[model samples]
Target: MIPRLKAWWRMFDTFTQRCLAVSVVLAIVASACLVQLVNVQLLDGRTTAEAATNSRTSKVTLSAKRGRILDTNGTVLAQSVERYNIIGVPDAATSFTPVTCGSKQAKSLGYCHAIDDKPVGATGAAAVARLLAPLLGMDAMELGAKLNGTNQYVVLKKEVTPQVKREIDKLNLGGIVYGELSSERVYAENTLIGALLGGVDDEGKGASGLESSLDDELAGTDGYTVYQRGNGGEVIPGTVTKTQEATDGKDVSLTIDADVDWYVKKVLSEGVSAQHAQWGVAVVQDVQTGEIIALEDSDSIQAGSDEAKLGSSRAVSQTFEPGSVGKIPALAAIMQSGVKITDQFTIPYEMEKDGQKFHDASSHGAEHWTLAGILQNSSNVGMITAAANVTNQQRYDMLCKFGIGQSTGLNLPGESNGVLTSPESWDTRSKETVLFGQGYTVNALQLTRAVSVIATGGINRQQSLIKSVSTSNGKQTSKLNTSATRVIDENTANEIKNAMESVADRWNKVINVSGYRIAMKTGTAEVAGDSGALTSIVADTVGFLPADNPRFVVTVVMKDPAGVHGGTTAGKVFAQIGEFLMQKYDVPNSAERTDAIPVEW
Candidate 1:
């Protein structure tokens, strides 16, 4: 085979051999080119194309519409409105030119660069500013200065209404001046529910109050759009390659009544001012549903204001000793232990028990008083004597059952679970003070709900502020996952109710609401003042209306008031709010009180 190959090679000339080698080399080069062509066209074509397109693509975030906050009666408390930010490309504005009239007839028609038919006689940034100044309510010279910058992008103005945006659009300053979509939150009742409604941050996220707590429900999923852009960073027409629609936030309806809240805030502010107090809080709740109809604070700041960002709702944040108002639970515990409201006690001005001295708010000689009288007079000494039958653990358990020393379940931001220590942690003095509401602390909402247990016939319903949430799919009622539990028997609740009614009857002059009966308890406690001394007073009143059949519970608290007594200061505010509630709800007149337990033996 080797000899035959050598003979065939000799048959060809040197030139033909060289030509054959060149042809073979050309064919090999062509084959390699073909392979590369196939690889590029079949294997990586899409990747190459995508890379080319991506270089010119732009993605824009689309803001989702934040949900509206509504009151129980469908009143819009807070809402997001369509707004626009006037964006100016300073580089583009420097070359901006307005359309000029080409003919005399065109100039007479006022279509040229003129305002009210007055010739602008300007170009570039000055002309652009003159066209937009009146529409934006800005000074022409100032606007011109903003447009004269060298930056590629500049925000001339933000949160302009849609009407103003349209007016600017009609000026035909297309590339020079454009609008970027945005939203502005507008509060209907400015400062009425300010603290409770909360406000959103600059980026439109909830910062506090209900806005922060329910942010997830209120802030829906934000979508985005991907599109091709021109060299100048402008989105090319019809070049939307990808898009995802924004999901608008769900509308949250609160149990609060806007009108009622406004009224309560007004009354509470006036009351706080009249008493020369530091601040005040008032809360109203529905007996059956446990809905907070109104929550007001004297120092309520406007929503979306700088001050609101720093503070929280005082009703759920501020904690103080409930004083005599804490006695009802002790009374309930004593009565539940088979002690009757008619049970008598020999009360003294002061008494010593377990090396601790206890006294009533006022000095009194030894007198025969029933258990009902002890509560009606708010006698701390009488409370100690009457509570002698109940154990410390029993008192602690009762207070816990009444929702003391715990969050009210409203889930408000900065809410405090007021300090309630265990029974074992209580000292001898604390044990006795706890009976009359001094050893522990509670927020206004906690104290309100505690009183509500009696009004609700011993059922401790979960307190809720958000009534429902409405979304794209449908409306969903907020389920707090907390069930109502019975704290006391119905008979015991009625007995406590009747005793509170007697207390209200005793202070009818200040607490009475005409045409309706009220069952109330007043409290006053000495807390640490600004100087850190026990000189400040927390005066509060908590009760339910139409004592015969309670419908609503109202609580009013005043801090460091001139009228150091709860019955006179906070109680007066309660009466005003109660009267307004009765009239607003059209509640029927209460029947005359037929059941009254005698107080004095």
Candidate 2:
């Protein structure tokens, strides 16, 4: 029995030992699996989604500058340049951090800090202010508080000079940064032609003048670049980025010649003062092509003050009774009506009709005066009598044909159509007064272009300011020169031109350059009061160079002045401008005079 019991005990001990070892191995394996699952489920990717969505990404879009305006001679009339902004990374800043950020997250890190220990240093604002104020023109203390960051970037200062930027960069202040931006408009010659060139706004948009008118062509499209980024919001260096290059604006070339424009304005201004007249305008245009060479007006718009102010573009827009200037067409009607250049009419000192008196400036008594003398002396009766013989219907037809009571179709804004009353309303007195230009209204440009019929050989080709326009797609469009329409016989117009040349004889006296036989006419247009009497006189001198082979035409008008006669006041300015023009353009001026009819009244 004892032996049997010993055997049983031994077997039980062995079984117990085996079972304990198996249990230990299983427990070890189970613990390993549990640890692996916990790490996979909760620890390996704690920040992946949070970092992807909550981590901020920042970017900036840069704007390209606008193209500049250049004169025909390549002078820069308007231009622009870049400005800069300085920034600071306050919260992400190492210097601004209360302590270093790490696995012990600055927020969760258990660390001992004194009550006096500020997140930004006690002198943080003062220190930052000290580092930046001198360089940025700012309050250092204010800058420090702004620079004191928990986890953010802040703007330090904006629009600092390049020199100041260089100074700031030299200091290497922690978290301080900069980005360049465009700023400032540069008028190369210092506002020499500021008003004409016009201005732009803060965003580089055109505001006035040629600049405003052509803004679309001047302002180009902006561009953008899109980039693929990685985990840290850093661009993937090798990955593809979608980039669209900015299309900059193309430069513009103007028709204006700066030197010639300056000279014209200067001469015209001096002449207006010398004439003692209210104001004046001088314009020179090509006879063949009708391109404007120079335009000068003393009645310019007074900027910042309206006293004695005159607006731009006077000649084409402002209308007045053309007075004797319109009589050229009336004279043409007479000549075209079979009146020869050597025709005759007895000039009367005062001619009365329908109870109204008409008289020439000089009271030369009625005597043997040819039709040529009648026109030369600007006699109202001679013009009326000559025009009266032609039916009112004939006169109206001729006037329309000559572009009277109509716009010259000049390529400028705000052009005027001169007043021409209907033929149906014409009484005999209306015929006479309209014949001498009292009953009609005409803008200066309209009359000037009408007179140009003489130079263009009876064909009037109008004037223009714009020459060309270029589009974004490289398509170029052009403004064509004036279209010519014949209004009179070439020979008859030339014959009248000979009579017109007599007008410049007075200019030759004041501006004696001893060259070029000019054809000119003097006009004194009295502004008729509502009560039927003359109120004021507008003096005008219209002329052309080298009458035989015409190249240019000019008109000078002086209004409501202390001086009396158009030939004396307006003619003098005419002569001065002509002399300078002939010299400047190298147009041939000879001492020989053309065979013109002698003046006798």
Best by TM-score: 1
Tell me which residue pairs clash in candidate 2. 82-182, 83-181, 91-151, 91-152, 125-144, 129-140, 300-310, 301-310
Candidate 2 RMSD to the correct structure: 9.6
lDDT of 2 by residue, 352-411 (tens): 877877777677766565666666778887786665567777777778777888666643
lDDT of 2: 0.66
All models: lDDT?
0.88, 0.66
List candidate 1 segments past 4 Å from native: 1-60, 103-111, 115-123, 138-152, 227-238, 472-474, 478-482
RMSD of every candidate to native, in Å, equals 7.7, 9.6
Q: Candidate 1: global Cα-lDDT?
A: 0.88
Tens digit of per-residue lDDT, candidate 1, span 306-421:
77766788877899999999998988988987888898888998999998888889888997889888888888998888787788889999999999987777788878999999
- Candidate with maximal lDDT: 1
User: Model 2, which residues run further than 4 Å from truth?
Assistant: 1-72, 78-196, 201-203, 225-242, 299-312, 392-411, 421-431, 440-444, 469-482, 528-534, 598-601
In candidate 1, position 4 carries an lDDT of 100
